[model samples]
Target: MARDLEFGDFTPAEKRRITALTARMVLPRANLTRLRRQVEDIEQQAERRKKK
Candidate 1:
């Protein structure tokens, strides 16, 4: 069986709280993966700008 996920709109304070909580819950491996992805994205953008 599949379940549908519910999404809600968050106020600025609520958004900040949720982000802080999530950051606390993130594992080191997951954090490393996120940093690698961000670095790759930045590098790709730099390469594109260089080609322009």
Candidate 2:
């Protein structure tokens, strides 16, 4: 049998565990900067291609 489990139904530890598992990971500063630069480069390339 499948039962729905609400967030409130979890104990404090269970809630914390669930929250930690589901949280988004923080990217490192260097990686974030590299990703931003790559995105900007892609956008510039798209603009150049659109002008052609």
Candidate 3:
């Protein structure tokens, strides 16, 4: 079975890499505002979890 991984499980470097890849997922001409909003949402969740 595949292991379930959470965002917090990654090292700082890995997290950065993940963010870079996520951004590149959109086409060069695609709408970026939507993607940025989604990424920000996930980041906020990570921050909230860290505070708990």
Per-model C-alpha lDDT, please? Answer: 0.46, 0.45, 0.61
TM-score of each: 0.42, 0.42, 0.51
TM-score of 2: 0.42
Q: Lowest-scoring 10 consecutive residues by lDDT in candidate 1?
A: 1-10
Candidate of highest TM-score: 3
Better of 2 and 3 by lDDT: 3
Top-scoring candidate (lDDT): 3
Model 1: how far residue 11 lies from native, Å? 33
- Model 2 scores worst on lDDT over the 10 consecutive residues at 1-10
C-alpha RMSD by candidate, in order: 14.9, 17.8, 9.2
Candidate 1 deviant stretches above 4 angstroms: 1-30
- Could you tell me the lDDT of residue 31 within candidate 3? 62
In every candidate, how many clashes are there?
0, 0, 0
lDDT order of candidates, best first? 3, 1, 2
